[model samples]
Target: MTATVRPGLADEDLARLRARVTGPVLDPSTPTYDEVRRVWNGAVDKHPAVIVRCAEAPDVVEAIRFARRTGLPVAVRGGGHSIPGFSAIDGGLLIDLQPMKTIDVDPDQRLVTVGAGVVWAELDRATQEHGLAVTGGEVSDTGIAGLTLGGGFGWLKRTCGLACDNLLAAEVVTADGRVVGASDTENPDLLWALRGGGGNFGIVTRFTYRLHPVGPILYGGALVHPAQRTADALRFLREHASRVPDETSLMAALVVAPPAPEFPAALHGHPVVVLGAAYHGGLAEGEHALGFLREFAPPAVDLLGPIPYVALQQMVDAFTPRGLHYYVKSEWLADLPDGVVDALVDHHLARTSPLHQILLHQMGGAVSRVAPEKTAFTYRDAAFVVTVAGCWQPGDARGPHVEWARSAWRACLPGSAGGAYINHLDADEGANRIRAAYGAATYDRLIAVKAVWDPDNVFCGNHNIPPGHSGTRQR
Candidate 1:
């Protein structure tokens, strides 16, 4: 069915839209509207005029058409995990892909075709059943679509590559209501854009990824040390992580220990530094390679050992549960300079909320071996990704939590690579930071591609790239 031609679509137009798709259409008055509109981030309180829980590509096409016809801005949701709440909009139309949760794994071809709504945990479980895997989100709850588009990183990244690197092809519903496929052979430029370009050109419905022989089990976990030893721990990590084998990946964090049963009650709620490591190789080799981390410092907690890869992926889920206010500031670092480490330790100690954390994810290996020009992700030489995540419960003052993250970010800027991981960036960082994320040349190329596929910028709800020939599309 074609869209109704009236502005501020009447109930009749909405009815027509509902008829075109085999999904539920939710409005403000609908009983489930509040629940459907809520995203993972509790801070987001947007109320879209309409929510279309799309079950298939045809439903997405109908939703986009309806938005265009009624002059409503469009927001697309997959897993509803966009940190900035990009999947929601105030008084606009939301195309939610949560119902499209299908996963098809081909063991012979080492390929997996996933619907946009499939989260990393679901994909991991399915793929692991066949002894196959792909580089997916560290937090299993993160959606495949948004993570891939923004250049995903995880424990397997050093051994394999970023999630985008494994993306072989995608099926997208473009702004003009045309269903298109992007691959090396078909619409190759669009495929290039999709490889770290954010959700600028279209709404992707499906992703096909190249899988690798990973593990049902691996040597991986974390070691926690007192906060006073943070400097020593970070310095040791910096020296050892750089020389580690390609199959080994590591991350360091300065955080307050959660009050969990695994942690000693005396240490709970105390500041601490953690060295998290994962080895994607044989158990013996992994143990030898990762053994030093466990012995580096006298830890208050030593949970490092052989663990199922799926278990490792979800280990941190308890700390990052839904319905908590989150604000993050991140930078890609070429080196972890002394000043940067000092700054991180200082800010971490000053954190107002125990839920906040300072994270440094080791990069390089296969990620850097891929030439910079091969994909839109420009920070190939970055040695690490630094993030200051400020989190608080409901009823907490927003000003202090946000300012803490910002101040920490400012302190680390001097040592930054002047670019950030696009997926880790916040909405308030604006266009200049977006340009910096992709670099000038790649950003220009993204804009050119945006002009070709979405000249009017109908898909501007993400880390948006405006069409080259037009001003920013009004949301």
Candidate 2:
């Protein structure tokens, strides 16, 4: 794969871009250039020729215009957490939105308006202050823009919908450098597309989300069992989770116990199967809902109880810290066949790295209640999302780890819905996978929307949806 030749920007062009916005325009020679180009994934090592740390919408507009005029591919960086490094580019323009982290919570209307740069942790803290929240990523460090656009899933998803489902409005800077708004009463078609249509259309500057009444503290934690008990644990989870109330969201994982103070020293670095349950309603009711799992079997560690929502959100942060070499392969399963369970257990036991984890997140609650046509997200009917993640330190060889995830994904594909979560996809998964992420009907509709908003495919760095043959490239 040869690298694309980046269109050169003349000195006058650089000066013009600098004069058009209030933000600082950094070139590769700048002292902070390398730091600005670094994304959360250590595997991506591209260096953009220019980086614009946008201060506001106007800066974003100027940056897009600069890219268009110079013919430099544009990459938008929100939380810099793009798993495949879509946020960074080689010798192109990187629109860095990290400086635009302003959040305004309107408790009166149960709405929270946040800048695209805001992460889930910041939003969770602010919304929890007023006893309200929207569905956000489990990892608090994930950016709101990328996660929501890719159809977010979190602990609150069963009780509430996905993050995109709660999105009421958005401010986007289109390909032609015009600021536009998308909402129910505004550009509703664009709003529908923005809900789950990756960044192919434009750059989102702000988002307004509808909040739901939730708790600052919820009964949620993990119950760990021995690795050999994975099949039994998963079988119990499958039955129990199917009948669990919407207020209860469940996730089962095969992970190695880290050497943290929370785990027993004897079990440190040991492989374990954990059933993590979170109930969003009253503490007593939550405990009642989670009682079966607590008493089902004796575990090495039992950490289920009333815990702060913020603490639960940050609980996995240690396992997924920034700069780790990571690769993820996921599939949406309509039903977990018995063979799939055996394969999952076998893969978990044969994992190349102890740090690797395989997760099964129970879907179908509020997530399924929404009509598929209502938004661009089409995977609402899935019963569970199976994610195979390979993680290792910097010096580790990438082949075995990546192969582990890919092989596991192949084994589980037989029981899948033939679709995937866009956010969890890897760079190697090509355009065909992108189309599969959005079903055939939704993919065609998204193409029409992309043609209307970005005919030239200016935002091609993401899980790109190119304008089809019907679209004429706009100057």
lDDT of 1 by residue, 1-475 (tens): 3233234668787998888999998888788989999988899999988889999999999998888888888999998888889998998899999999999999999999999999999999999999889999889898988999999999999988999998999999999999999999999999999999989989999999999998788998999889999988989989987899999999998988888888899889999998999999888888998988867867888988899999998988887888899998899988888987898888889988899988999999999988766678889888899988889998899899999999998888877887888888988998889889988989889898999999888998888888883245534
Question: In lDDT terms, how accurate is model 1?
Answer: 0.89
Candidate 2's C-alpha runs over 4 A off are 1-7, 469-475
User: How many steric clashes does model 2 contain?
Assistant: 0
Q: Model 1: how large is the Cα RMSD against the reference?
A: 2.3
The residue pairs in collision within model 1 are none
TM-score of 2: 0.97
